[model samples]
Target: MVIFSVLYPATPGGRFDQAYYDDVHIPLVKEAFAATGLKDVQVFKGLSAPDGGPAPFVAMVHLAFEDAAAMQASLAGPRGAEVSGDIVNFSDITPIAQVSARD
Candidate 1:
């Protein structure tokens, strides 16, 4: 299995509006992600810093896939492109994406 994560740094004074994101954005992303082989999805908001520094990101997203190939395929697929657009509207900056597995 593989998990795709995205860390989105908030703008200088930006804060995420959970209500809108959960009610609108997430559903759109979920629909788009489903078309790109998404298995499960999780979203989180950073409340505080564990490292004694200001939290760099206001939001984080986790997406589970069957494997690395599946994650890659999904991101490169048309539906993924559509989903990516949602990110732009949701955040002040581009998100940092990473992948991990059982390894």
Candidate 2:
């Protein structure tokens, strides 16, 4: 399996609508990605840093796919564009993305 991650940095005045993200955006992601071998998804909400400071990121999402090729396919085509474009509906911060394979 492969993991595709999206992380949002915590800006001083960052604006994120968690409710909309959970209720609206995530469902859109599931719908768009499921057709391309998306297996599962996990979400994280950053609370604090190790030293008790605000976490560097406000939130993160991990999408699991059948394989590396499946991951790439998930991000291609019109459905991918639809999922990506929905980011503006809930957040102003640009997300950081990474792809990794399980050991």
Candidate 3:
């Protein structure tokens, strides 16, 4: 399995609507990528670091896919564009993305 993670770095005065992310954005992602072998989606909201300092990322989203090829195919389609464009609706932070294989 492949896990695609998108991390939103914390910034001073950053704005993230958690409600919208959970209620709207996530659903949109599921709808957009479900057919391309998307298996599951998980979202994390950052609270604090080990030292009680602010977390590096305000939020993170992990998407599970059947394989790398399936993930690539999903991203190559129009749905990818739609998903990417929807980011502005909830947050102002530019997300950093990573793809990983299950250990």
Local accuracy by lDDT, each model? 0.77, 0.91, 0.92
TM per prediction: 0.80, 0.95, 0.95
lDDT-wise, the better of 1 and 3 is: 3
**Residue-wise lDDT of candidate 1 within 9-97, one digit each (tens)?**
86786655667777888888677767557889899987768877777678888889888777888888777777777665655566788
Query: How displaced is residue 83 in candidate 1, in Å?
Result: 0.7
| Model 3 CA lDDT for position 47 | 94
User: Which segments of candidate 2 are over 4 A away from where they belong?
Assistant: none
Instruction: Report the CA-based lDDT of candidate 3 relative to the real structure.
Output: 0.92
Q: Model 3, range 1-103, lDDT digits (tens) per residue? A: 9999999999899889999999999999999999988999999999999899989899999999999998998888779999899899999988899999996
Clashing pairs in 2: none
* lDDT, ranked from best to worst: 3, 2, 1
| Winner by lDDT | 3
lDDT at 48, model 1: 69
Decoy 3 TM-score against native: 0.95
The Cα RMSD in angstroms, rounded to one decimal, for candidate 3 relative to the true structure is 0.9
Every model: Cα RMSD to truth: 2.2, 0.9, 0.9
